[model samples]
Target chain A: MLILHCPYCGVYAEETELHAGGEAHLKRATIGDSDEAFEEYLFMRENKKGVHLERWRHANGCGKWFLCARDTATLEVYGTYPAQTTEPPADIVAAITAKHPGWSWKEKA
Target chain B: MSNAVSALNGQEAKGDVTVRELGLTGMITLRGDFEDENFGAALSQITGAGVPDVRHFVQAGDFTVLWMSPDELLVILPYEKAAETVAAFDAALKGTHFLAVNVSDARALISISGDFANEVLAKLSPVDMSADRFTAGMVRRTRLAQVAAAFWMLPDGSYNLMCFRSVADYAFGLLSTSAKAGKVGAI
Candidate 1:
């Protein structure tokens, strides 16, 4: 079992713990485009052989959104990074400290 | 007055929310890499509770499996067996590639029984608690109010939920509201 590190949830399983959200770099087709254009964008498939990036949900872990890259054939994951990262997004430490003015975050884990 | 009687009478006073006062049971958090055979052996030796090969659980007397993650699991034992199980686990897992944490103080096991238990659970948890999906000897590690939790289905058709004691009151309140809403067609 490959331990996939979720940038937010930390390391998790490669199976049901994470969900494959499909191929990355999917861009919307321009409006007023021909049927052929839409068809090529939607129905067509590259079925790439190697080094493909995708999206995944850490359903069991931290539940944070992130991206992942892997080999389609060998199922060998290359790397994973946060998909939606923000500066102090709902900072758990700061929030807790604010709630408890006397409590020390450094002392508590 | 007895704690259980006070709780039953709905006249019990609240103490530290994180520190359980009443109507809670043993909650031991077992963290280990299941990929290790030695860990499995140590686990079996510890609580006399073997990590079942399946996704759910198979009880061994008083102990019950609560959560079986890829690398960790949470077992819910009776209050009487708490210290013994913890010590046994510590002894077996000593110097091994495993971490047995006694989180009895961290999490609370609330018994949600009676006729409206399922309806109450349906409010916060996404699990389908119908008999077919969730029967006796079944356990599900899911989310409650978007927080991680483990729900164990008992032989009596009741659900023993293991969640952080800090969130127990909030979760219970949510469940109670949902149950009442179900009765009044408020949903």
Candidate 2:
């Protein structure tokens, strides 16, 4: 029973009240993109066991989609942010870096 | 007009608590920038209640303003006044980026009252129904069993709940069943 905070509604919603949207910050492959690129965009995902970023919808509460960063093994939530943001906020990134040094998403240090 | 009917036609059930269907209540869905001066003034002028803070509601005379989300509000009033209220919004907020529509017929209202009203609701919702955590003036939008619903505590310790009209019978049944299951004795 994972409890996550909804950044939009400011409510700590249980997993039952939310819908998981898998990976976060996905860049869709356009029409002219290569088949491999399109396949990577559609199917490939990071199977990180430590820090992970994911999308979640507060389906039963505010009905807003948001992003979450958490540890897959320890279930320690890094933070939650609005979906409109392109990347995790500086404070959230700093928090993640503090706990897991040299950690980066998509090779962006 | 006269032919309009409520979802359950004013049905009610009795148990440890009373679950009564409040027939034909008026509701309006309003979405806009809460920070806009015109938005706040127009809402206060029409509803006679200030814009409520997050997760809260304010009542004045026959009107209640509920904060549904960051940019949405639910205005509850007498059923007969819905159309006029919507027109009033158009008149007051002519150039503002706002939306106010009559939703009176699309939803159903229910009231659960008695000593164990909170206990009855606690069985279905994931919200903290404890008196200290959820008190008067606060509104919570949550799932009631399998359906989406919103509820708030009244001044007299009762709760007024609302859900889509299509599930009125189901909501009534759920409420009554929870009321009959007896109290949990733990807050």
Kindly give the stretch of ten consecutive residues in candidate 1 chain A with the minimal lDDT sum: A85-94
How does residue B138 of candidate 1 score in lDDT? Answer: 67
| Model 2 accuracy (lDDT, Cα) | 0.92
lDDT of 1 at B150: 66
lDDT of each: 0.60, 0.92
Native contacts present in candidate 2, fraction: 0.58
Best by DockQ: 2
lDDT of 2 by residue, B59-127 (tens): 999999998888999999999999999999999999989999999999999999999999999999998
Per candidate, native contacts kept equal: 0.04, 0.58
Off by over 4 Å in 1: A1-52, A55-109, B1-24, B183-187
Q: Enumerate residue pairs that collide in model 1.
A: none
Question: TM for chain B in all models?
Answer: 0.75, 0.98
